[model samples]
Target: MDDLDLRLIKLTQDGIELVPEPFKKIARELNISEEEVINRINTLIEHGIVRRFGASIGHRALGILFNAMCVWNVPDHRVEEVGAIMAGFDEVSHCYERLRSPDWEYNLYAMVHARTREECERIAHEISLATGISDYTILFSEKEFKKTGVRI
Candidate 1:
């Protein structure tokens, strides 16, 4: 990545504009062509400098008010298998395995989003049934304080 590419990364760290021609707008700012802008981004993605280029949806704005993290106390031997099963759910936005602590026995974590708490619980139940790991807990969020794009 050259200076222009670095500048592009800096400009896009937050997110691209919600415009009909966001690349065009970026091109104007950088004094480059729109196609160049897209090519630079594509190059970054192809080289794995940028893992993903996508939108960060506001689920609450879309009537998905209930959000919770479902933590499962999955066995060490089954962490990857169980995590993948939970991650496969459409209701789950993100799921992964983490290091467990002495006080906290849960290792698998999944972020579940729904319109209501009952729906969230329903998804959790389905995950439990699918994984056959019943030792789990669901902690609902009272509010969404922060939702922002990642910095490069």
Candidate 2:
């Protein structure tokens, strides 16, 4: 990546506009054409320099102040299948499998976002109905101690 690419990454690593022509605004700032910005970003993605290009919505800003981490005790044989089902839900933003233990019977974790605790429970019910895996727990968000984005 060149200096301009680095500058672009620094400027937009956090976020970009939600408008239709966000790249045009970025190009204006960089003193380059919108096409150049798009081309550079595409090249970066091709090389895996830019791992992802997307929008991040702030739950607080959207009045979605509540969230939950729904942990599921998925069967070993059904881990992948169940995880895929969980990930397919629109409410779920992050989902993955993890090691389980005697004390911790849960093997799958899916983070669900909602505006209220009740909404979180509702989404969890939908997930359960979708996956047929009722063995789970939903831990509601109390406070956000730390949150960060990717950096180079």
Candidate 3:
């Protein structure tokens, strides 16, 4: 990848257009062929530079009424096991493991979505039972501050 490839990745991060010839717009801006733009994106993913290509939807638009961030105190040896279980749930939109601080204990984090706060809590309770990690925290969003792409 070169400077142009980096720029392409940054530009595409804003989310691709929902049109037929999306790459054509990008190619025009980059002064390259549409085929080249598509090829480079594929190469980026092949080399693991690009994790995956997809839209970042507004959950509200899709009738997702509630969202919560769940943090769990999973044992070190069972992090992957518990994380995978959480990730398997359809209610979970995002799940990962993060470094813990001295005061902070929960390491496994997941984003749970539902049509209501009660539903979100129900899913959280089920996850607690499945993972056997009752010590967890759930933080819900009051409002969305920003939603956009990162230029990396």
All candidates: TM-score? 0.87, 0.74, 0.87
In angstroms, give how far residue 137 of model 2 lies from its true place. 0.7
TM match of model 1 to true structure: 0.87
Cα lDDT, all candidates: 0.90, 0.90, 0.89
lDDT of 2 by residue, 61-140 (tens): 99988789999999899998999988999989899999998899999999998888899999999999988999999998
Tens-digit lDDT track of model 3 for 22-116: 88889999999999998999999999888877766788988997889988999999998999999999999899999999999889999999989
Model 3 local distance difference test score: 0.89
As for candidate 3, its clashing pairs are none
lDDT of 1 at 25: 77
Indicate the worst ten consecutive residues by lDDT in candidate 2: 50-59
Residue pair clashes in candidate 1 = none
Off by over 4 Å in 3: 16-20
Better of 2 and 3 by TM-score: 3
